[model samples]
Target: MSSLSKLAYYLLHNHSRIAANLVEQGIKEMNIKIPDEEKDHAVCVYETFFQFMGDSLEQETNEIPSKLIEWSKKNAEGQIFSGGKISEIIIRYPVTRKIFADLSTQWAEEFSLTNKESIKILQKMNAMLDVSEVETVFAFEKLTKQMKKDYQKELDTLSNPIVPLKEGIAVLPLVGTIDSYRVNHLMEKVIPEIAHLNLNYVIVDFSGVQTFDETTASYLQQIGSVLRLLGIRTILTGISPQLAQIAVAIGAEFHDVTSYTNVKQALENI
Candidate 1:
């Protein structure tokens, strides 16, 4: 029983018309009715409830717990006007908070998510309130698993950071989302592979990639940039027009990257 709820109870029960008239007049709460000593205790109860309602409405958007007991002690003659009447009032307020709480709990349980995931869910809901995309939500879950697997592979590759290719020619397969994490791993793995295999050329195959975005294009450029510095030629394969468009859009410098459509084509040219 929060003060806001208590206040709402009294407002609706006693001055029910006040709620309607307030909406008409754009008034959140009516003026408080302070009771005279000669008047009935019911009058005092109503006055106290009115004032409390106003104050509760004032603090509507905040999450502060109600200091209602302290308030009742200071304002009313006998701390709080408690009886069967007041008990009935306690159960009378709107059940909006209950509804919202249930909705939130449902979403949390559905996702089995916490903290950042909750924030992301809230943000997505806020952004796409009307445009319900069920498939997009399903895709996000699937991609989350793929992203986790990609991250694990990155960690393992970083531990060794170098894979020797057949006949001392290394093949560094670039797959999944190519964010900064993958680019950093590429830097770590590239030079070591070049040195360990005594390789003159490293074939960076992008054939298995499902999507090509600017981030991935930039990462490819970064790989080529570093490999050139290590005195190793980087032969990029599977450069789709979409990939090239992304590279152009981001102004990714791919001048030195000798590209082929696939590994066999790259090998023939090398």
Candidate 2:
């Protein structure tokens, strides 16, 4: 067999040992510790990586193995789910790359491979690592974005909650700074939820609100209009002087809606 073929054969046969050695050397060089239980899994990952490397060398192709790409995405998802930072995995890459390069050179020497052949192997290894890194980062970003969206949806549901006061009365206590996002959330989600409650009255209390602006006043007017159309009486409570001025400035007429000083008074009157 040719020297290149022999080298490929050796790599395929010794991949497990090479992977173990790489892991051991990597941990020591990076001064990082892996838990005893996790050590086996780490070695297994490296073993699969090395096996794929051998396959690439044997085929003389630069194309990365599909198994490795799938593994990278799955690993990224696992890191996110386990509350582990992607940086933790990324920080070790430089050292890992160095170790792999050194091992490739050592193997080339041992097998008496030509410099051209050595460079080919090293280039293929680097290409595979690059693909793995990109796949991992892409997966991490996609999953993190989805998680944030889901978390915001949950917060919106909690923030705009409709607390039933009585048989036909409910309160929507607006807290925090009012923004366009919150207003849109109310228009889309809260309005439908309120409609389903069969409530005759809804107290929109703005006492806990930190700031009121012209935009918020307009949104409030819109909400009041929708509630009125549903035959639900709208009660405005906790309207500070500042909020009242802003509503008037924005031309948000509340003449048809009932006004009260606070929730207790609104409840008493209702």
Candidate 3:
């Protein structure tokens, strides 16, 4: 066999040991701890990576293996699900790269491979690792964004809950600072929930609201109009003077809506 083929054969045969050593050296150098259960999985992933590297060296191509790309994505997802940061996963790459470089040099000397052949192995290893890093980061970012969107959807559901007070009465409490997103959530989600409840009165209490602006006034007016259209009497409570001023400034009329000092007053009168 050619020197390059022999070196590739050696690497392929000893990948498991090389992977274990890489992980051990990485953990020691980086001062990071991996759980016992995860350690085996980590070693397996690295072993596959080394095997792919060996394959690349034999093929004399810099193209990353599709299996390695898939594995990198899975690793990124695992990190997110395990409550670990992407940075934690990425931080070990440098240590791993150094270990691979050292191993490549040592293996070249043992196999009596020429300098060009050794450099070719190093080049393939670098290319595979670079692509793996990119894939991992991209997957991590995409998952994180999706997670934030889901969390916001859950928060919106909680913030605009329609709590039933009696058979035909419910309270729609608006909590936290009002934003365009929350306003849209109210129109899209809360309105449908209110309609399904078959309620006669909906007291949109703003006692917990921390923001009063022209846009907020407009959204509040729109909600009141929608409830009126559904034949539900809308009661406005906890409208501070600042809120009242903004409502007037924005020309948002609540003439048809009843006003109350608080939920207790609205509940008692309704």
Candidate 3 deviation (Cα RMSD): 2.5
Candidate 3 per-residue C-alpha lDDT over 154-225 given as tens digits, one digit per residue, 9 for 90 to 100: 998877888999999999888888888899898988898889999999998988887766787778778888
Better of 1 and 3 by lDDT: 3
> What lDDT is reached at residue 8 by model 2?
76
Clashing pairs in 2: none
In candidate 3, which residue pairs clash? none
lDDT by residue for model 2 over 215-263, one digit each (tens)?
8777878999899999899998998998777777877778988899999
How many clashes show up per model? 0, 0, 0
Model 3 residue 197 CA deviation (Å) reads 3.1
Give me the displacement of residue 143 in model 3, in angstroms: 2.2
User: Model 3's lDDT to the true fold?
Assistant: 0.85
Instruction: Give the per-residue lDDT of model 1 (tens digit) for 1-270.
Output: 543344345454645343233222321222223334422333343344344444444444322222323322233223122212222222212231233234345545654546554454344323322121222233344555666788777664754334455664667776655666566665675555566667788887766555656676676676677677777788888867876677788877777668889888877777
The TM-score that candidate 1 achieves is 0.40
Which whole-number lDDT from 0 to 100 does residue 29 have in model 2?
A: 94
